[model samples]
Target: MKKLIYSIAVITAVIQFYSCQKLDIAPISKFTEANYWTDIDKAKLMLNMGYNQMYSAGIMWRDEFLSDNMVHTYGTSDQNSIRRGEATASLNLFANEWKDAYGGIKTCLVFLANVDRVPGMPEATKNRMIDEIRFIRAYLYFRLVNYYGDVPFFTTEISLDDAYKIKRTPKNEILAFIHSELDDIMNRGNLPRAENLVAEEKGRITIGAACAFQARAYLYEGNYQKVKEYAGYLINDPSKYGAYQLFQYPAKKEESYFMLFTPENEYNNEVILDITYVPNLKYWTNMSQMAPISKNAEISADNPTQELVDCYLTMNGLPVKGTGKDPAYNENDPYVNRDPRLSATVVYDNYKWQNKNGSVDVIRTAAGTNTSDSYKGPVERQTKTGYYVHKYYDWTMTPNNQSGLNIIMFRFADVLLMYAEACNELGKITQQEWDTTIRPIRERAGFKVAAALDYPAAKSQGEIRDVIRNERRVELALEGLRWYDVKRWKIGQEVLNGTMHGFRFSGAGGDTDGGYVRVNQYKFNDNRDYLWSVPLTQMDLNQNLKPNNPGY
Candidate 1:
């Protein structure tokens, strides 16, 4: 029995009704407090509500716009505004993200407070469920602190008066709390290892998830030692955390990387934590807005930028520009002799786009091309950039583009990359580390050349860091992680400033900078853009939320 909690179950109605009310108001439901916690299934239902709020596919997809990886051209979006350095404390993105994260935290608290009253639940099962809720709470807090430096922190639900008066906790304190909470949950030994989970419990929280999340937290904190120690748990002892390896297909090596996102590969060992969705039931329609215009998509909201395309190294592991360039890289035919992931991720001019009826069509995005996907100078429902995203095309999507593919939040490849980065930062990276982490990732990406797999000789620490960072970018592009990486690396000004470019169409008209399409000029205030402001609406409700982020 596939027992993953589909988010659209009847319990969702109850959550929606309660979620709309203010946080100060008590969660009202048809079932009174006395009867709601009487059954184990009801407890699970409440937990499912927390799962639904953990992550959103739409938010994840839009996050790329905040980074240099993508550009929004259709119209103004909150992410676009923020990227352009026009974000105010009143931006809906800030308010909505704050509200949604707290709502999720509240769901976890409610579940933890009432689950003990559930009758006939096995001690082991109840304890495991409690840890799961705790993990969700920690994850929510992690997001909150990452976005807003300091926020009002809480564990148990509070009264209306207490909620209003609660002051902002220091970001460091919140980070420490998250670390301690995750450590306690993992040390308790109630959660199962990733490999031990049965089909019915596929999407439940595991020890590996907690460990990976902790490592990511340390990564954001720039504590390389802690990142190494926590990420080492999975890298060194798979028997303890879980045996996670990059998903590969030896017969079809080139297609292995992209195939990992297909529906047939859901619940693969590579995925550490993912949002669960059921076909024809709980699904997302964001793909309809992202798919190619020629492929019957409703609208093209954003497009991959040339900056992201340039990050992919050649098959021989050489840069396309700067020092140690690829000698065979052709300027006119930039797609050839490049990393296989680039083709898998983006659809450029003359790209092959497969259709629902098993037919393939070539997408032409150059100016004056006879195709709906052609470049038309930043018009509505068209790609401003001369490219379309091909990484997440759900073959099993409905005619209306409703897709049920689970969105992976954490995966094994990311774990390896994190370990590699931490090792490099600590100056402890060796050939063995390279073989285990970067080498395998490149190999699975269909890179057969020894230069791409073997550890480079006579390279300084800085050079190795660049290689690792570039590898992480191409491997994890369009996964909503680029923005966090940019923020953590403090390269917002270096990357976000100046004009973003699209495909190079020689002799194209209108806003062409030496044949490159000028998508848009962006600005990044290094001091203020690094942290988002506390929403003005939030501050109005609670005067304690004073002293907003700088330059707001």
Candidate 2:
């Protein structure tokens, strides 16, 4: 549980940029460049450090706050700025992404540069470690390119002189390198396939993880062919992608899909890669506190948006027909007959959560629904958006909930969803394709009704594309992929630019927009907000990263 931390130790006197901090400090005095990497265990420790830093801090929640999934009430300045069309460059390493990603990339470069020095290890073990570092490096750059369009790119360790002279590389070129790097790791490197890995190495990258990330990167580039190829690699063959299958409905569990997020089901086949944590160690995460229940006496930050709630399909696999539409939905019984995922991912009125003792803690958000109890919605410390996030809440660690629950970065269900999207984009989609992927997801979500489980017939690419996208939203809700999705789809202007809304706490509902609260107006300046600008201080340090991205 003891984490080893390191710095890249580059000798530089020039003004430091966020991406290029003094690469020479050993956070722990026990290890330094002179004595470190002298043994296999030491080298492995550094590699482990890379995994620790790879997606630390805000990377998990950035997708939700930066996109339309959550209505931010209290959080970081970056979250507020990104939502308000005013992301400044001062928040760099990534403006909206924060400083941790570049730090992670720096850690990888340091490890890749010195890992070979370690002796007494089998060549296979060393190569596997190197492969893992390569994957982390590629993944970090993947994040960089997604946020800052064309960032200064480098693979090897560089002096400040060379660093200052380096200009931003084209994003497509870096993306291509990310793809090739992942491909090399999966095809050429000796990383154990997911099915072959031991319990201790459960969260590490495997061929399936590499493939899933590659498909995701290609998806960003609009490379439908490559997306289809990589996703299909995982979808068409289970053995090839770690024998992944949906977590089936458990009779005793409150909800079938919720089981996947519980500690008892950690590292199930459905998960491709997860940012892991350990209890009573440096790895235990406080993310659970961000989405605390009303009575838990924790900070309430991430409130689920009404926009996201409506994204789920009705039980009939059709849009929730609002009043005046065919087969109009009744507002009084809004949660009934809805997509099963709605109850799984969100904590709404009357949500049944679990306790460590396996008892159900019914969450009553309505006013008078819990008049005698201290825990009720629309009260102080309650969610501003009328809903709370429950997707990754660790019930066992509640109250003093510093959870060891791993935050999933990529999973097989995402690959299937990606495959469905890619196939639809390529004009090769069919009802059978939906049945293969989307149907199973809903069915495993406890949707036994034929209307919700059956695939739709005879739809064009555009229609199915929406279906696939919405399916992705509901299936992966609150897992922090929504921002990237909106960016890649080029729909930020449409989704993030309106008046955000939620439920009426006063029981005054009459119309669709009635009794709702206006949270904030999310402004998206299509001219520049899509790709954030580099830090102004960084640009000032090195003029090479010139012309801050558009409106900045």
Cα lDDT of model 1 overall?
Answer: 0.83
Instruction: In candidate 1, list every pair of residues with a backbone clash.
Output: none
lDDT at 476, model 2:
87
Over the stretch 1-552, how does candidate 1's per-residue lDDT look in tens digits? 135455346676766655435643222222336666888877888887777888868768977778899988777889888888899999988888888888788888778777888889999989998998898899888888889899888888776667667788999999999999999998999988988988888878899999999999999999999998988898888887888889985557678897888887888889998888777887888777677887768888788998998888888778887788899887688888788898788888888776647698888888788688888777756677888888877889888988888888899999899999999999958998889899999989989888899888668889899899999999999999999999999999889988999888765677877778898889899889988888888788778888887889
TM-score of every model? 0.96, 0.89
The count of residue-pair clashes in candidate 2 stands at 4
The 0-to-1 C-alpha lDDT of every candidate, in the order given, reads 0.83, 0.70
Q: Which window of 10 residues has the lowest lDDT sum in candidate 2?
A: 6-15
Clashing pairs in 2: 8-23, 9-23, 9-24, 10-23
lDDT of 2 at 107: 67
Error of 2 at 133 (Å): 0.3
- Per-residue lDDT of model 2, residues 1-552, tens digit only: 222222222111101222334432111111234465677766666677678767753567766778788876654556767788766677643533424566566767777777777777888888888898899988878877877888877887666576566688999899889988988888875877788987667788788888888899899888999998988888776666667777654565336587888888888778888877665453444454455455453666667877888787776666764432326556665777787788777777776766668788777665456522222333346565667777777766535666767788888788888888887888858878878888888777766767666766656678678778988998888887888888889898899897787655565232335666566678998888788778775677678888778888
